[model samples]
Target chain A: MFSELNSILNTSPENCPQGEFTLVSDRKADASFLIHHFLSFYLRAGCKVCFLGLVQSFSHYSAVSQRLGVSLTQAREKGQLVFLEGLKGALGVLLEEEPSPGTHMLGFLRSPRSDLRELFEFVRASSTVLLSLGVRVGAVVDFAHYCRAFVCSKLQGNMVMLIRGEDEEEEECDEEGAEWLLRALTHQCSLALRVQGLPTGYCRDIHGQMEVFWRGHGSSVTGPQTQQKLFQYKVHDKGVSFFARGTSSAVL
Target chain B: MLLDIMQTNEVGGLVIIQDTVDCCGRQLLKGFIHCALKRDEVVHVLGFEVCENEFRGGLDSKFTQGLYFHDGYTDPLGWTECPPLTVHHFTPQDINTCLSQSEQLKTVTLVVDSLSWILRHHSPAIVCQRLQELRRGGALRSVLLLLHSDMHQQGIVGSLCHLATAVILVAPGMSGQHTVAKTTRRTKSGRVTREEECFSVSEDLTITIEAQSSCSGKTLPEPEEYEADPAANLTFNLRLSEVEREAKEKLSLPFVFSQEKKSALLHPRPGAGRILYEPDDNDDFDQEDPDDDLDV
Candidate 1:
């Protein structure tokens, strides 16, 4: 499904480099497809994957991964996948008289200051356990900074994060932190993928556009020679197709 | 012009490079690094955003000789046992200590890969105050700060810009080949210079300044240009020609009454006063009194 994207990236799941941080951002478009692609790709690579399902539930991801030829339930039973459902955990922390041990990772939710140190420690402990199992680890999380240092430096693993781009019209106080976090992560990430909808509004043929920025200074197969590239993509039930911007079917 | 400013012995106290997500200012920051190294100044980089390797990437090996990096990226919160620099309690004093590590600190260029990170972790007022301390202490030659303008609110960006001696706004140029930098520099003599230039950074960390599109000192529109008639673009004529002016002066408007007519109209003969009334078909005039029906 991601053959075209792999070709453009010049690296597949098998040969993908470790200790690399990839940031996926979207503006006026949903980039959850890219997240699903990376999640399944890394899992198929036989790496221990820690899925921090913040924006969606485990069933949603499991359903999507099933369509992509991967069994998340089976991966979990085999100890290759660790799924942390943030929504469920948050509710458990809020309503449950006694939160379960597994939900302790979300203890930061009950804190007055909402400090993420507890959550960071939780991720660290999990990653350590995964590392002890003698497998490369790949973490899919929204909070990159909490696990970035440990995941990339200590474990020598890869981290892929998805953050929604800020809308210029909305200036909410909560969004300020998100915006700063996005910029800070972009500076640190080796690769950045941005998905944006058509500025001209909805189109029938072309869903949206994506830009890949190879900002990594690493000496890998795909070096920073190709700084950036743009492509138009259409998402399908089972797969997504990416083509050069002007080469979309409608444009032709 | 940007290169010229960097090459000079005395750059401003605080130089802020404002860039958006589309047009990154990292290349420009590296350009400043190269210029600082070329001038034989001690360069200390506080990298909170990227690792040392990534920061040093694409830079010439020779340029790295005099460059010192304070590791704020790795173990920023000191989650690990030991980190070279911990951002948990970052302050100007900590930076001063970092600067004092190197000998020959006569002329030092402190490059904050980004001040936005510091601003996020710290209050804007405190950050500005620390920057002022760093500037006023005379410990460093100059401070080069990289800021993501879109990431911060306009008020915060404005305050930071107010603190900086020079601000360079980098935007994507019309052509993708280069980026345009609009620089506004305030000199010590109270003279402000603004210029827009196109610049492209090569792979080897070399910056080539292209054509200068405009500069306040050189390309400013003259006073006469501002004084030019604004009616030039109007479809109708606003000014009359010499012959037309003479004809307009000779012509008399019908609405203007002479002194004699004015006095005559104001005084008016007593007997000449009369009322003229005309009733339309729709108008019903009751000339007869309704009281005639009553016994009055």
Candidate 2:
């Protein structure tokens, strides 16, 4: 006996909601179902899990995880196990970039292999919705800020990019210059997202800024479209981004 | 950048990394501890998936202690309900910059969460250069006992190994009936060294299967392109010497040109691009042959 499904589904608020809720399936492929299930549960739990895997098809797991969010442990204990596909609904974030329209492209470390630590602030803020929003009183984000933060927080998902304005190279790089250009995107994670390169699509240098493009496709209805400016960064911590979370899910 | 040394001068200390320590400082400590330890040691850690709520809960004398930690990216909630650990939460830049930047410890025992993306994002050359520079600055006293995981897609780790005082590679050893293989080859001598020692990290992030023994000259890291830089100024320094030689050669040219011709020319005649350093008497300057006549 669920209270409502599409009621709040369509009007989903911008804030990350923490509650105990069940996820329903909408006839997606096997992978989509599993992904949706777990994603819904985590979203309600107020935990941001950066679901990473192959960049395509992650539904079966999503759906199953969503359906059994609460009783999954019990289900397994009673010999009632629901096995789902692993590879569906798997595209974590899309990549698209073209060129930036400014005369600025600075290398992070050096030309050929530039260092990228300079852009960590922007990336960190963009990764978590709560990180981008106003201060939290308890766990509640300001509703208004929540909307903008939700949109801005996902620069990698929905933002389109146009790197390299005119065919000019050689740009000056100062901390201030790159910071100004590497601001947050407005809307995040949508279908028809555009990016040109790896990670962030654009880089600003002494010459100018270049734009890359990518498209983000949420659960098919295609979330709002956006284009994150060429906000790029390269962190120097070689082992920082990855940590073995201990044989996650035991190979599922 | 000056804090990576250990009191002992050996290679690598047992580095215990968790969200409670500074990534940068602990990294240096890794090198420092390795360099300082006279005997093999064990490093411990607890955080994230293992002890999220109790990340820094067990630093008491009762529980095992890790050298230090830098909270890179901890679980959003932190180790459950615990007030943020007393440890500092430095930005990625701080940790990254100092890994090689700090020379406090060499021969460090480094234990990190993962090594894949970190290797790709930050080239190991930069890390080594930072370490080398620190070493030159007398920041570290000994070799480093590095403790790290081989993130599946690590880049230039082989090259990084070259600058290491000694390398200790740990990974999944083997499955039932199958032998797990992770080998390091020395670049100078193309010898293939098999590793009899093995290491395993338990689910609790504790160190296991450590068979630390002193073995010399097992392997050399490949002298790949990533191995080229350490002095950071090698290119500039070499280029300057080359330019100086060329300038001297140009000034000592055998040309009998007018004073104005020599005065006006900034470099060798348009086509000459070589930096010939030797002062050969047979430079053909004095040859009577028409083909050998010096021309500006």
Top DockQ hit: 1
For model 1, residues B1-296, the per-residue Cα lDDT tens digits are 68877777574478999987666787788878987887667889988766677678776777677899998876665665787776555677788889987776458889987787777677889998888888887788889999978777888999998877789999878765678889988778766778998888777767788778845455445588779776779998887899999999887787888897789888869798777889789656666873544557
Off by over 4 Å in 2: A1-30, A39-252, B1-66, B74-124, B141-155, B175-194, B198-296
Per prediction, the TM-score for chain B is 0.75, 0.34
Q: What is candidate 2's lDDT per residue for B241-279, written digit by digit as tens?
A: 777888877784566686777666865677867676664
In candidate 1, position B271 carries an lDDT of 92
DockQ of 2: 0.03
Return the clash pairs for model 1, or none: none
Q: How high a TM-score does candidate 2 get? A: 0.30
For TM-score, the strongest prediction is 1
Task: Say which docking band candidate 2 falls in.
Answer: incorrect
Best by lDDT: 1
For model 2, what is the alpha-carbon lDDT of residue B139? 27
The local lDDT score (0 to 100) that residue A74 gets in candidate 1 is 97
